[model samples]
Target chain A: MIQFTNISKSFDEVKAVRNVSLSIDEGQLFGFIGPDGAGKTTLFRMLNSLLIADEGSIELFGLDPHKDYKKVRQIIGYMPGKFSLYYDLSIEENLNFFATVFGTTIEENYHLIEDIYKQIEPFKKRHAGKLSGGMKQKLALCCALIHKPKLLLLDEPTTGVDAVSRREFWDMLKSLKSKGITIVVSTPYMDEAGMCDSVALMQNGQIHAVESPKAIVDNFQKELLAVKCNDMYKALLTLRNYENCYNVYPFGEYLHYIDKRDSKPIEDINDCLLKHDLQEIEINPVKPDIEDCFIELTRKLSV
Target chain B: MENEQVIIVRDLVKKFGDFTANAGLNFHVDKGEIFGFLGANGAGKTTAMRILCGLSSPTSGLVEVAGYNVKTHAEEVKKRIGYMSQKFSLFEDLTIWENMRFFSTVYGMNKTAFKERGEMLLRKLELFEKRNRLVSTLSLGWKQKLAFTVAILHEPSIVFLDEPTGGVDPITRRQFWEMIYEAADNGITVFVTTHYMDEAEYCNRVTIMVDGRIDALDTPAKLKEKYQVNSMNDVFLALAR
Candidate 1:
């Protein structure tokens, strides 16, 4: 369990996290989703006690992350976004060092990280820097779990990893969650938003929305449409500049647009396209996904 | 020509001294497809990519990237292919426009080519106004977009991007993929890697690597079907477990 009350963090003149307050439940996969400089990492460091917040309080497992940094370190496992593991040490050696630092051994919590360990086991003798992106992730996860902390804090754990390893790593977290461990994973990937039990969509160091991924999507107030035309670029410009459009953004092959007139007649779309000289047009009402929710939320908040 | 493979690797093995980073890897990326190369951390994906980019050598393997043999025609391959490294390594001292210009010159683009492509990319990325700003002053998401634009300055046959959207917001990432798709539509093969499964869904084909070998390779739909999971993330967890 974790709690932050009116927490504000700043680096010199810039405020990273501003007046933030939230709670993360036990045995949950909590995600902090935002763009870079949104203050997710700053919040992570404060919660982990690497950096002290300028104002407010952070409590982890009933202990303050700042004042009780030492004890918090004992009960919480943290994997920083940037590769913070010992690069010079071999995979086994890095794991050993982290375990020793946490006053434990790999064998003690081997079961917690076993799924990840197996992949990096063959390279137990390979230097940490020498390992590939996926292996490094496995090693970091294994090391984090060595102490069997009740809370795990991972900052963008899947950033540069390949898709498969990214998937496998999340699965490892899921299994760990089943064992009743409170996991906190931060990522810029909005799609990963669905995987968490709850998420806080952070922007500009403030909490925008916090809820289950599905709940966020359900909360989307606009009716969405996926549209494609002969020239998507030209079409996007046409759509964005279209009259009374709430939101018009490109999503792969189609432009996911929301109109102020959600229930507008289909004939109106053709009439609008005809005016713009846009041909090969198709529009279908579509369900809003996490990204759509993210964009919609940010747009409304900014307005 | 429509279905021609852009990057073809067979029995690809890459060993750095005693460590075999990539082991007997085999895969093909078709022309104009956005292929997602995936793996867990330490999963040999980067190793295989570096070899195909001609940045590193394969101990023993048969490989072709844009029709050039990686070993014998590395320079030619380098010319025809673009790469965006995982770590954004833009020149901080240079202005955004200057950086693009420098890279264009490095790729041997003529003045006409530079002006034509430069304006096109800047407009496409919405970086036109800030082109005069130093690279260091740009936001992370903007820098990422610019870095990607620079990679394809020469309009390489294939663009290999390694986690090009790290630490950016989801909205920017969505926009970034759209650019990649547009590039693919123009007959430029895209070989990209990412830790996000949703991004993987955008790829024509995806390869998931575990422990220096590919554990699965297929479209996101096929992969989901193969692993009996509704999502690619779940599929990875199943294989990893």
Candidate 2:
């Protein structure tokens, strides 16, 4: 449903996207996983035809975005990274405004956003700005889906939202996807990447890898160890200084450490920490997740 | 132990007309501790934080920071505390050095001290060469770390961070928390609010606010064990429910 061929975009002297090419199948939920300056926003803007690419080409359902952006927008729903709803308008008023803009009525496309709108209907009279972060996101999603668009482009919809709200938002997207709507979401959260059918691991305006979360993680070249001790801060410092330690990062309560030699470096790690008077040291072998894969990929890119 | 309490609150209450934003909130933060404040949206986290930071007046109760009463000495409390919100307070158009100079001057730092500290900070962050570059040109990760450096530049006794790692990548967020850890190691207490459950796990202790009151306050491991959960997210869901 979406295709890009050697697409390149630059802001002044910096290339926001460079020779990137990718495709999204119809009805598939695609995630662009990357950091803030990773060009996901720039690429999304180009797809929406809000910004024109400096080079290469883009096709939306076999139609050139640059040549047919007017009609293309009618079938695509976009929620920008920053909330763009009318803060002064009531929730119901915002929905009505969005429906009217698309030359439709809320009743006609009520099923499209029924599940989402039901969550925010109680506060229909409240101003959009007065709603909570989760409510605002639901209201925004309702507005975006008010016209029953075929595709949805959500940019970091769960950013800054609580974990519960984030889960609910993704569940809403899953329901929408079941209805045969293609969704392209950009998020910095690596955990959310697993929820997508396929994701493009992007960094520095380049697509490092494009695969299912499982496949990407399964391809992790190194074995990982979840390292912890009585004193975590000192453990991290000691692990970083270990001769065979390739990378040491804080992962929740424990540190994720990678070794240069793959042959069960647990004894070596234990000895290194044991020498530092660290006690109760625990090192467990683990599988890499999407965040670890992304970090490793970005590290490779940097080097 | 009593002297270690950098922040002490007793029955703090804040009401917005009829709604009780903070319902008799009470907590104590020890010196050089990383305290995590976790809650659902509109769960009174921001309201309680505002009261602690002296940005909002509580309806009733005692609130103290750095051994000074928040009500009677808001200015004094503000001077000894640094705050960095999710939306950073840096001048985008200004160069890195100019932004540092502006904030230091606002905090009444002397010229010689500001110059020495500013250069040292930038070099440590590897941004010394880009000191003349506009802040707007820096990446989000760079800007976040820089903003954090600026927040603690004045050597405040406590730093209040409201979701300081919002919208940042996982790698960068980890690095940002490293800076927080370094500050706490240097004897600067950190009182931070975060939505990430994993981040809450990094704190020395965490308070979970629900419906304008603290539902639970304890270390992350204890909370998880008490709730029979493996992660802070589950513990939060249990409390919020």
Model 2 regions more than 4 Å off: B1-3
Which 10 consecutive positions of candidate 2 chain A have the poorest summed lDDT? A227-236
lDDT of 2 by residue, B1-241 (tens): 4339999999999999999989998899999899999998889999899889988888999999998999999999999999887786789999999999999998889999999999998899889998999999888888889999999999999999988876677788889988888888788999989887877988989999999999999998799999999889889888885
lDDT of candidate 1 over A1-303, digit per residue (tens): 689999998777888899999999888899999888999889998988889988898888889887888988888888888767888889888888988888888888888878778877877888899877777888888888889999889999987665666666778888999999999988887877878999999989989988998898899887788887766666776777878777787774567888888586456766787688889889888889887888877777878
Quick one: best TM-score, which candidate? 2
CAPRI class assigned to model 2: medium
List, residue by residue over A27-137, the lDDT tens digit for candidate 2: 999999988888999999999989999999999987887999988899889999887899999999999999999999999999998888888898899999998889999
> After aligning candidate 1 to the native by TM-score, how far in Å is the CA of A43 from where it should be?
0.9
Q: Which parts of model 1 have CA positions greater than 4 angstroms off? A: A87-96, A99-132, A228-238, A252-254, A264-283, B1-77, B111-129, B155-158, B181-195, B203-241
Candidate 2 clash pair list: none
Error of 1 at A301 (Å): 2.2
